[model samples]
Target: MAIKEGLRPGGRSARVQESIHSAVRELLETHQRSTLTVPQIAARAGVTPSTIYRRWGDLSVLLADVALARMQPDGEPANTGSLRGDVRAWAEQYLDEMSSEPGRNMLRDVQCSQTPGYCVAIIGAQLQAILERYPDQPGPSVDRLINLLAAPTVFRILFSAAALEVEELHRLVDIALGQ
Candidate 1:
């Protein structure tokens, strides 16, 4: 079955993906990621190692897939009553989350994936939701915000010794907003 399930409920591929993803999540709760291997994951997932390789390419890719899935927005952005406020709040939140240990690991997993665009689209959709909230006002495009806001934040978190300060995040918001 294809790793990328159609998400059709109860389908064979969907069930397989679900079990595999669940198995990975379960194992991570008990074991260090460095200790995991294709064989172990396959055994826990009740699928063959060949199945995992054929679908996801490698364990890193599979972990990346799981990370991307987890990164999808749970709900709409916070409503702060103004585009600036909402955008700023979102940026601050983004910086906070992405700079953390787990978030950093997830970002690393995503970088190892072949489909980085999917992760970008996920973040873009999140920003789009914030943009949609204030339709009456002009705001930066999601692409622009990603370039100015998210990109820098991710860069600092991934490359720099420290994540952006809240002050820096605020400045990024100002720039992204063209303020």
Candidate 2:
């Protein structure tokens, strides 16, 4: 049998990772993030500090990894009758979520991690599901929709102090749909 080099889901490694993620999340809820150390997380997770370091390289990256996992949607995007409707619905929902305080923090964490664009891929999957409804007809690419919709929404979320308006989000959907 071939050997697996790293973490694999639903296996022993997954259990360790999940434990670590849980520890980090739990600790963050109870204590200041700045106060947490790798050893504390390792102790809470029932793993060694070296294990966390070997898998995640550092605490910041580990935090980012956990944040990204939390950001995963519970379900696929809602199905609307038309592409425009679906895209708008998804965009509005995305703006609502990403503009929130917790969402913004998660967004920042994943950005600082070794991998960027993990969030983009999550959105792309949902967007692709929406596009599948219009298979016989031509529609905007997922990348195009992301650019015209998610990118701007995330920009306002991360940088702007004010909340993003739904009207502005729909306008982005319109631009993506070329309307």
Which candidate's lDDT is highest? 1
Each model's lDDT:
0.85, 0.83
For candidate 1, write residues 119-143 as lDDT tens digits: 7788888889989988898999999
So what's the TM-score on candidate 1?
0.91
Candidate 1 residue-pair clash tally: 0
* lDDT digits (tens) for residues 1-179 of candidate 2: 00123456577887888899999999988897779999999999999999999888888888888887887789988887888988888888888888876787788777766666677888899999999999986899999998989888888888887767888887878888889
Show the lowest summed lDDT stretch of 10 residues, model 2: 1-10
